[model samples]
Target: MFHNFLVTTEHRDFLRFLWHEDNDISKPLIDYHMNVHVFGNSPSPAVATYGLRKAVEKAETDVQDFIYRNFYVDDGLISCRTSEEAVDLLVRTQRILHDNGKLRLHKFSSNNREVLDSFPQSELAKDLCNLDLCNDTLPMHRSLGLSWDIETDRFTFCTCKDKKPFTRRGILSVINGLYDPLGFAVPVVLKGKLLMKEILSSTNSLDWDDPVPELFKKPWDVWVQSLTELEQVCIPRQYSDHSYTDSNVRLVHVFCDASKDAIGAVAYLQLFRPAGPEPTLSFLLGKGKLAPNGGSTIPRMELCAAVLGVEVADIIKEQLGIPSECFRFYTDSQIVLGYLTNTTRRFYVYVSNRVKRIHSASSPRQWTHVATEQNPADLATRSVSATQLSNSMWLTGPPCEILTKTLPEPLSCFPLVEPQNDCEIRPEVTCIKVQMDDVKPVNHKIGSERFLRFSTWESLVRGIKILKQFIYTFLKQSDIDSSEAY
Candidate 1:
């Protein structure tokens, strides 16, 4: 694939290499430059991708769209409803890339035996090349990190036996090695993450290569041993047997919850078929994140989980092309439900910002309350073993009761805020103005004569000065009256 694109003359300088000719050390080293993008070159992927897209510029709309959306570097993955459609798409894509860019598109694998029969065995994946499609069962193939079981058409997990030191780095490597982009194993993997967090946060700081504390050793070993059970866990690749567009009603339910140790959200696709007696429910995605350090209230943690639920729901909605109105959000915590459904109450900064995010993507009418035991996201916020995860409702989807039950009356029916104490609720403060009756000023003569009216020394002095002024005015007027009488 990389050899299909020729490197420009100016850029070939960066691809120059020194080589010894004919294994003769006596001879001077020969400098050679690569004319084409080669493997191991950093720019090869981008260059090849651009070249591939450029080659298919005038191809069929479907082919162009598939190339643009499905191709990851060299490999292209897509799903089709019918075996014929799959075969046709692969054939056309292969022919277009080969005719235009001289690129070979091969090693194709599909769950349908008919689809494989349409292509030559030489072009099939290495595992399928020698197999007799008629006599043998299809084998498991790894696609984009996830193990694909073509026989069952389901995605499965396999654990690697690579042993590493039980140090911080080793533990982290084991945790990161599990590539679950769809979050199928998030709950199980979350246990390992929490364990690593505990080890790193020990009172004494430990280096990457340093051994973890002895106290955490047993739990770490237990987690490592549990990986073997992951092979038992498998999820359907296709959401439902029937196409969602054919269904009578399609709904997306997202459940979010939080625990002291973690917070998380899980989404499921519910398809109501017109003819089928019961609706089909499938797990779409699951996400588990550790709670913020320094402690957080359950309500706040639950709020974080709600935000995560909205994000997960958005992704599922966009991928599934489901309408936002058909999506509903569930939370076990009434506080979170209140936060999402709140219309009149103002919240503190933390709750306000998160509430705004939830409201922006979803409406108050879309959120409703669910009992704790019924919430599938509960598995995400807490630790669960591989066995539990394989059998947990988190994978199989929400409980049967939830699947059949009607959605509660819109957010209007639910209480806006809890009657009891809630920390997230911002206290409402009111300012009231009182109009006191007017108090008339005291007459100077009356105030001076009544010494008891003056409480403080300053008031008494003020009253005395007022009395002296009054006496001087009266005396001046009396002198005039006396002189006139004489």
Candidate 2:
């Protein structure tokens, strides 16, 4: 087959020299002494030869050793391309030699077919065969790769030469199939893809469709439905105007208590007048001790505190010339409430008697219990920080300092009221002196007098009145004081 090609005259002469030793053309011809030799010269020989020579030169020593070690036969007399191929050929040649009686064949008995049949066939057997074909055809099938054979129940992968696989189901399908027998409903890839696409499409359109507006409308519709249902049920309209002849009639009552741990404890004396805003009067009765001093127990302290608060209200009623019957005391404490409400308890009996005495002395009053949340004075009974105490004081009344600032020059000349105790009176004297210094002299004379003549006791009395008036005015300005402060 090689001899039909045209050759140079010198190459023809060399070929004649090579053929002289070989009469039969079937034997592969080789010559050690030949000077001219060309490699891979059938077609595009130059490129092929150059590539092959480069590959061979670049091959590692270990690879060359492996090829020589595995393929060597008869101490390098014969060689083969691979160890497996050489082994197979050796076995075949030996078998032929044995059959000719040049060598003896070793005989072994096979196991029974029934025994072999007892073992189950592996599921991978068909897959292995399919894998072999897939590997063989991969180079040709570029656009359309072979798919896994579902009918054969084989789990195999396919590859393409250039283009990506088209017909082949991915690893997800194989996993789904394997899990199917285990009763798990693994999601189908096609179905999952479709669902994902649908979700993506919806998400893409969300902005354009104004989904937020639609979402808002749903809640609005629900609200409308709820309102409609509410409308179906009859509800009485709130009366804007209510009439009452006696504004002095009190309705709400309060009682309060405190312990040594609670120093600035206060309670409310709420008087719910029919024709006026509820009169919420707050009174601070010192509660909780700084140190253990022989004093009333928590309950007794509470009762005493309640009494002190009531006494304050009475004093206010007298000082302001308001009727006592117009006030109603409120308390959350059951003990205090019992003392005021219960006629049977000895202490309550005493309280009732005292109340009767007050009523006889002045006018009748009411007392009642209130839920703690509604009782504003509950805050005072609890332990409070300085800030909280200041805030509560501001809410209840004007601070003494603020009152001093707001008072008229004539009113500012008055001395602060002092307790009867000498120890308590000394602090008042100091505070009054400081306040007197703070008061600036008025330039204008009143009624031809350079300054108003004032006695110390009279000044103290007037100072108390001015402070009380300032408290009322400040309370009127604040939201927490309620409209009753007027």
Candidate 3:
């Protein structure tokens, strides 16, 4: 159609005007023209000229009318023999009118004059003309718009203005638009084969489930293996150096405490050979129950308990055969250690003094900190229900039978003695025995003294009468009469 129109003599002048040059056209348009008409090297001059002339005449005569009539149809359909011919005519006419400023308009109307007036100004009109020419080269049917469907195996295109039959070229164009810029430009006929190859290649080359191929043999793995080897080799040697022989009885005494909230604490003491565990005899000091006043602050209580523990250890060393210089102490209380070692703030002078004494006495003993979790003494300090306490005792090594039975009673054979006058009495007393039972024979002699023992009702009455007469005689000698007192 374009070739035939171009060859017609009468349309030659119109074509020149459409190209926007009486003398020369833009390089792009000239290239477009050369490619379509001459570069393909087809020997069909008459066919090309005839097509071009007809296209020009149709564009000049009725391009607007044809577009208006077909704008609403599926694919913007028209009665023209071919869509290509219609597009060519529309492009040529728009180009001519736009360059001459004849197509510039502000509105569209049925009247020819109104339609002409609606054409844009010169520059904008030229842009619209170029768009129309481009559209002519890639003529889009209104019905051939793009559609994507993941479920379908094939691409589909339908008219943009109305639903209509699909076209192969339309679908190809749509697919190209979708994938071309993403670098997949395989022709549609071969797209399925390419897709299948991609899928198979990925599946064959890589195992999705075993994604991390290097983790099993990576640097981290190698480092861990090296560490394990080092630990296995070194730990025994270290232990051997510190181990005790009968001739060199090294002692590692551990002190620990448990609390209800935080886990527990342990302290260690190391003694040299020949000295035996008795040198680390800090543990021999009797344990004291923590005062019931500060239950809420476990850390504070643990700290205080640790201070007491160290004090006890120090006293045991001095009083027992333990040499303070040979002892090495360990504790879970960082706070107590901090104060003792001057590592933290000190608040209690008494505790600090006790710590100093322990430090001075135990020349070989060094105080070290351990995490509460590793502290075994934790079991002793924390309150446990009877059952839990019983279970814990079983776990700890001891006179193993103590786990099954209660703690053994300490020896207390002497008769019950009244608190001496010089001694101040404590507010409460806890003793296993009181004076309610049968009187045991007393071995010690007493100086001459009046003594009353009430064994029955008659003896108790007689004793009261005798005590009342004595009190009456004493009062009369001191002063007032009995008659006035009653």
Candidate 4:
């Protein structure tokens, strides 16, 4: 792809490099000029992308938006409703790029055998080039670094079997090694994160090489064994059967929940079909995080989870091209719903900052309440084995009651409690100031007039000392005058 773009004449000099012929010391070094962008060149990626974009703009094709949105640098990933549409779009894109910029768009692979058969064998991915589509079973392929089984059209996980010592470094390596970028494995991985946090905190002399405490050994072993079960779990790559062209009402439901240990949020894409009574719910994405250190209250944690839910919703909305109005947020906590719906009451800084963030991305009307049992995000706040997750609603989605056209009566509008009762609320403080009729204004140089000018603590302290001295002198002088008058 980088080879497709020719470097401008003036810039070729900067890309020049020294080369040796056949690695023979007998020959002198030869200077070469790079006429085309090469791998590792600083501007090569941008040049290639810009060339593709320019080609897309000039080409008369329907896949312009597809290329722009789906292409990550050179790899193009897209999904179509039918094999025919997929083939047509890809072929047109290939032709346009080839004719316009001499760019070859190849290595195409698809879940549909018809789509694969449409392309030339050479154009297909290397693994598919030699396989007989009719005789051989479809093999699993890596899409953007995730294992995708083309035969099943599902995403699968594989555990790294490499062995390591039972030490902090090894534990960390194992934790990060399982790369579920979409957070499909978050609930399972979250337990590991909480364990690591505990190991790091409770063990004072813990070094990278030091083994975890004996009490944690069994738990670590159990967690490691559970990873093998992840291979059994498979998630559908495609969200729904119907495409964007279908007359279906699309909605995104984001559920958030928190426990003592962690906070979690999950978003699902729901489609209300005209024929089907129940809406189809597909897992979009999920996120789980260990609660921050130094301790936090349940209400505060719930607020944090709400913020996370909004964040997940925003990402889904942006990627899916869905509008904000189509999104609905769910939380099991009345306190959190109260915080979001509260209009008259002000909150303390911790709650205020998070509430403001939630409000920025979503409005209060978009949020509703769900019972603890129905909130799928509950699975994320605590530990769940791979087997449990495979069957759990965390991946399957929430109960139908929550997705109905008319949501359960918004949890009784829980009135925002008084600030004094809730620490999260900022209590209204009143200050009384008395003015003396005979007292003159403070000195502009050293009194409250100069307080705002001090930018640092030291300067402010010094200014306050000067102001105190001035006030003492003025009061003493007034007393002396009163005595003389008497």
Candidate 5:
């Protein structure tokens, strides 16, 4: 529930609205002028919604908090732990939206029948009933372009790929249409992004419907074919929807890694059941990005991956309402691990900034190393078929038994390279002054000069004369010896 419920009409008055309709040869003409801020043009929806948010924040505290956290544009969405709380929120939220800001919340659907009981039948969604109740199931409910099967409690994807002409712009449109906010499709979607990057980096700019270049033909076809298999994929909608009757310990495992092509991170929830001897897991969310055309080193990209991992962990903590201390960060990069653990060495600007972000999000001690072979984020950085992703341990989380045990040794022993200080060290310098009249000249050879204020030419001449005499004596002795021997 959002609009310009805050913006004054005076502020909206300055904008002009105009249109015209005229016949060619001396016929009638009509011109229309818009009266009440009807301009809809914008690069961002913020222009329309931000004003209402500000007004609500200024007056209604509860409404502001809920809308700020849950609302997008005119739609206000939220979840509740219990049916009572949901009904209360629904009533209070409607009152706030109408009273505080002239907004009406509608198109509401909920899995809990009790929550939707108070609403008029006409106002509710046509097919919002429980599917488990009968063999005939309702179609999937949609929000933010992703489909949710309320009956099954799962996030389902519907893959509909028609044989359309493939081009850079078409690829971009399709990639943009993939509403994977949770990044379950990151491994599959990243391939398309790489192709787009390749096209943009090329010498020619391609049209929206132009044929895919010969260069990208094979990879593009393989990726598009894999897209068809995405219909089979279904990730658990909730990280921990079921009761953990047997398990008390819960941990969040976030993995980070980077390849030459890209960098990525993924967060997963591990539910340990000591009695069962095998804990269960659920995929939470993940993130990925292609290497910029400008390029970066693998170590730098690894550091970026760690930063991404920390961000994902922080978001998961906030969304799941989990304790920060329980979060653990994993990465395959030794350099990143060392950077987080090393307190003695300093890093260059790029590494230092990213390391700072990682530390601020989670403690360095929380960051641990996982073997490259075991890192799930590798699937995202490198392309994978949809089949691989659907069957991959990456989406399902690692087998809980093996992933929880055998953690790596601490990274303190593997510190980063010691940083060198560039500024040079200089010896201390002193100046001394003497009066020429009171100074005494020093007598010394040039090679072994005396430390004095001044030296006279006479001392230098005497030293040279002594050296010449020693050389003459040695030569005369050698000639006499030779004559005696003959």
Candidate 6:
């Protein structure tokens, strides 16, 4: 059930004239203060969305649960094990949206003939299947942009053959044509994205539909041809069948890895069956990011991958409706592991912020090391042909044999490294300040500014202290050498 919630006057508290909309060119010239402030796919709709969801919290039990879990920014999506349950959910959900959230539920759809029969066709959105209307006809519905066959209960793709030339616009048309929001096609699609990057970065002024350089022309055409076969690749809509639901021993394992060209993460539901076999896994979702033009080193990229894993894991945790303890994150980089495990080691701002976010979603104990060879996210960082992605275990999990092997887990607490000698200088020189008699030591102001680098006066005093210490140490060493000579 997808619905629209009115952004009410309650959100406009002292926020009136501050919001304005430009007049349509053909319409009146006066600037109009817009009442609906949450338009244009803006982020502010979240504030109103939360209020509506919260309002529905105490409604009928099933409706409350549906409102809590299924709604995303006002669009509600849910699946039921049975048509009877669907009817109950549908009716209750409709009432809760209207009565409590003051929302109107519309655009309803389902494969079950009985479920659709209950609602007036006026209340339902037109089916995209382009098929004749009937009680028994199953239509193709788009759930969150992935093509879903209501009859088959599998995920499908809507593809169009690109007859356009091998130009910038043509390449973009074909690449953008792929609608794999769950990233099932990413390994295949990334090849095209990287190719597009090459073409765009090659010449800033290239016309949108102009012919590409001879180099990319062949590869671009080949990739476009491969896109049609993507429709042949269908995934089960649900991660696991209801009859085959995972036991409580299931864990959400998120794998992160990076290459110089890209970083990616893939999540899976690892289900441990009681039959004494290796834990099986079902692919939940995957994410990928191209390396920025301002290049980042491999370790930093790996850290970026780890941060991405945390975000993906946290999201899957919420969506899975599972206990938070059941979430685990894996990364192949020892550098990232050290950063995550070390409580005492301070890092540069970039690393620090990422580590903080990772720690926020997962405990240090939940982070485990996985061998690069065993990391499935490696496929995400590198390119894979459509055929390879379809057959390979990367989208799922590592093979069963690899999963059976035990990893030598790193210790949770990293021991702080001692200084080079008996010097009092800090391990992190940039972060620590040298203690000195401040002309007014005990009476220093409460909010005095701290400096990462020394000022001129402090530098002079610091230089003198270093020199004095060096001279004294040299004289002592000379005396010791003279005594040995005598």
lDDT of 1 at 458: 99
Q: Candidates' TM-scores?
A: 0.83, 0.24, 0.24, 0.82, 0.73, 0.73
- Decoy 1 TM-score against native: 0.83
Off by over 4 Å in 1: 14-34, 38-44, 404-408, 416-425, 429-486
lDDT, each prediction: 0.84, 0.35, 0.36, 0.85, 0.70, 0.72
lDDT of 1 by residue, 1-486 (tens): 898899899989999999776668888899888999899988889998999999899999999988998889988889888898888888898999989989899998999999999989999999999999999999999998899999999998988898989788898899888989999998899999998888877825778888776888898899999988999888889998878668989888889999989988988888888878688888888889998676588778888899999999888776767878988888877777767766777887998999899988888777777888888889887768998887798898877687556475566666656634777677776868854333743331243346777789899889779866876787777765532332
Query: How close is each model in CA RMSD to the real structure?
Result: 9.8, 43.8, 41.4, 6.0, 10.1, 8.5
Shift in Å, residue 112, candidate 1: 1.5
**Model 3, span 108-200: residue lDDT tens:** 111122222344434232323343432233222112232222122122232122321123222223223332111111122122222223333
Flag regions of model 4 displaced more than 4 Å.
6-22, 25-44, 202-215, 275-277, 405-412, 429-486
Q: Give the alpha carbon lDDT tens digit for every residue of 1-486 in model 4.
A: 888789899989999888776667688888878998999988888888888888889665467887778888899889887888888898899888888778899998999999998988999998899999998988989888799999999999989999878888998899988898898988999999998888878876878898877988888888988899999999999887755557368988999999989999999888877886666788899999999886698888999999999999888877878989888888998888888888877877889999999999988888888889898999999868988888898999987766784353443475675546997887787878954444644432224455678899898878778867876777677765532332
Per-residue lDDT tens digits for candidate 2, residues 353-462, read 55444344332125444455544444444433222332343124322232223222232222222224212112223343322332534432122231245556678668
Candidate 2 vs candidate 4: which has greater lDDT?
4
lDDT of 5 by residue, 85-120 (tens): 777777777776667656666667776666666677
The stretch of ten residues in a row with the least summed lDDT in candidate 4 is 440-449
What ranges in model 2 sit over 4 Å off?
1-255, 262-292, 345-365, 389-486
| Winner on lDDT (2 vs 6) | 6
What are the clash counts of all predictions, listed in order? 0, 10, 51, 0, 1, 0
Supply the global lDDT for candidate 1: 0.84
Please give the lDDT score at residue 259 for candidate 3: 55
- Show pairs that collide, candidate 1: none
RMSD of candidate 6 to the truth, in angstroms, is 8.5
